[model samples]
Target: MLDFHTLAEFSRANCVSICAFLVPANLLATVLTIILTALHRPLHQIWQAAGFASIFALIMVMHVYSWFAIGVVMLPTYILLWLAITCLLANLIAILWRRRFVNTPSLSNNA
Candidate 1:
């Protein structure tokens, strides 16, 4: 099958370039998410931020997986991944909560 070791080596070699974009993107997305949450903004806005963060997180995880493939275990990677997952879950729960409990009028009263 797939030669993960080779892939790991390749990723490791390019870690700097990969992280350059991911780090800033993740930071901006997370910051926006936090701001939206603090402001009590609409669920859709929060979702947008969380969605972007989650996407970046997934990409970062691939880089972390490369380290694992190469037999390099880093605690920071686990922490970062956990944070990413938590943020995504929080956003999802907010959306679900709004959809489930917040009632919207199905029809207008006036003709």
Candidate 2:
């Protein structure tokens, strides 16, 4: 099995490429989701955007994990991991909230 050292080395070697793709991807996904939310767009549309954001968040999580595996616990790494987790959890909560509460009809109107 591949060890943490090996994974860390691999991540380090490809750090430039990883950042090139992930930086822009994460930025774009996050911006789009925020814009969609601000615009009060449809729930389905927001959900789709959040889905993409979650994918990027998962990738960030893996990248952070790789660094952590090598015992590199710097502030930047910690912030990145925190951002990823926050994005993922926020998206999940937003989705669940929309499904469970936003879509439900009020009972007072039935009187």
Candidate 3:
């Protein structure tokens, strides 16, 4: 039978491993999302921007929490995540603003 301490250690190790896996996956997904947005302008609409921003923010929070919980001190990693989230939010706001205010001229005006 596994002792309490051994069980605790296993749980901690599992959490750390999961965090390690998630960090890279989240990063890759973020990068891919950015690339896809850039390559396809239509896909970079306001709603999509907001959705991506939220997803990026969620990933950053998860990474940070995981790092802290796992007792890792990757300062540069934390900074990068913060920067990515900030940029995402800014872009999302700009997109929402444009979508809300940029009205197109209606064809009825030509009559």
Candidate 4:
């Protein structure tokens, strides 16, 4: 397993290349999913929300890890990471709750 410091150094060294790949890839996939869902309205909503939550959580985790790797261990970073984790867990719970109990027909009719 690579340490945080090593990962940070690698990220700094290949910042441009990493951004070029990660940013565009994430954007493209999100756009494609949105487009597909818009076109196919009957697609399950839970799947979409779950996918989004998972992606968001992954991004937050990556950010926290990167901050640790970059030698910027400070109070603000700690707070931000704590918030991110909390939000991620909340979103995950929401997704699970909606999956288990929320009815799509009732929600659609209500809306």
| Candidate 2 global CA lDDT score | 0.78
Candidate whose lDDT is highest: 2
Question: TM-score of model 3 relative to the true fold?
Answer: 0.43
Sort by TM-score, top down from the best = 2, 1, 4, 3
Please give the CA lDDT of all the candidate structures: 0.71, 0.78, 0.57, 0.56
Once model 1 is optimally superposed onto the true structure by TM-score, how far is the C-alpha of residue 9 displaced, in angstroms?
Answer: 4.9
lDDT tens readout by residue for model 3, 19-81: 565556555655554554454445345456556556655655655655566577788557746
Ranking by lDDT: 2, 1, 3, 4
Candidate 2: tens digits of C-alpha lDDT, residues 15-37? 77876787677767867776776
Q: How many residue pairs clash in each candidate?
A: 0, 0, 0, 0
- Taking all chains together, each candidate's TM-score versus the true structure is 0.62, 0.68, 0.43, 0.47
Report RMSD (Å) for each prediction in the order shown: 5.2, 4.0, 7.0, 6.2
lDDT of 4 by residue, 22-82 (tens): 4544444444444544444334664674476457546645765786765878785576466
Alpha carbon lDDT at 15, candidate 2: 73
Off by over 4 Å in 3: 1-44, 103-111
Clashes of 4: 0
lDDT per residue (tens digit) for residues 1-111 in model 1: 899777777778998887777777777776777777666677778777778777887778788777776577778667656765665666566556545544654356445
C-alpha displacement of 99 in model 2, angstroms?
4.4
Runs with alpha carbons beyond 4 Å of true place in candidate 2: 1-9, 96-101, 104-111
